[model samples]
Target: MPETGSGRRTLPTVADTEAFGRELAADLRPGDLVILDGPLGAGKTALTRGIAAGLGVQGRVSSPTFIIARQHRAGDHPGAIPMVHVDAYRLGGDLDELDALDLDTDLNHAVVVVEWGLGVVEHLTDRHLRIQLHREPESDVRTIVWEWIS
Candidate 1:
């Protein structure tokens, strides 16, 4: 919460992964872009659930793989931050496809979380939080590394 910069953390359970997300979410704000890089069955979605929870967005938070992107409005709640969850796994060679979502329009008013968005969404912003999650062999635990670029 004190702008700790970049570091790594190990989560032993699904809940732990989400909790870690909540912890990381403490410093998030509108226009924040979080790129989650990891393999299938990794804790990418789980961590995003925690982030959405911390943002005070309503409704169930799930992977938007099929739909590609899901917008969670902050509603009438004062101080609530809106969220845009995107799945870049299905994107092709051109990330310019992201242009169709019009993310730039509300970027200053929403938190954008993209799964498998490494090389795909870097052009969105120069400042962002990059989180990479990796699963341990035969273990439910996951190792998450984070970097905050300004």
Candidate 2:
């Protein structure tokens, strides 16, 4: 298993952001929880898309804003893990609503990723990867800072 660490990156394009996510996924496991904090247009969904690709999960990864969550099954690769992508913006900090989704249960079988989940999802796990994305003013560039918190 990879040790806990933190780092920052400047992504020049959407592809760069996704590539970074793919790299991050290399250290993830089935029970990992990843919280993404960012404003609108920060490429959170794109990063999740990359993570899905890296994990070899089946499905076209997309924002779960409307549905709140989406589960992607593992692919054919040995030891492949599934992914549960979530958009928590609509939850409005309601823990009950969050709990209704039973994400903690999914964590045991999939990598649970929550967007807009800084304060809301941390309690679901003892340790988690927190990633903050910042989009430059009036530009497509993005800066991402992340760390594994325990």
Q: TM-score for each prediction?
A: 0.93, 0.96
Query: 23-83, model 2: which lDDT tens digit per residue?
Result: 8889899899999999999999989998888888998999999999999999998967899
Clashing pairs in 2: none
**Model 1's lDDT to the true fold?**
0.86
**TM-score of model 1 vs. true structure:** 0.93
lDDT of 1 by residue, 1-150 (tens): 545389988999999998988777778889989999999988999999999888888889999989999999885667778999999888864556778877776587999999999987877876888999999988889999998877
lDDT of each: 0.86, 0.92
Error of 2 at 13 (Å): 0.5
Task: Single out the weakest 10-residue window by summed lDDT for candidate 2.
Answer: 1-10
Model 2 TM-score on a 0 to 1 scale: 0.96
Residue 14 displacement (Å), model 1: 0.5
Best by lDDT: 2
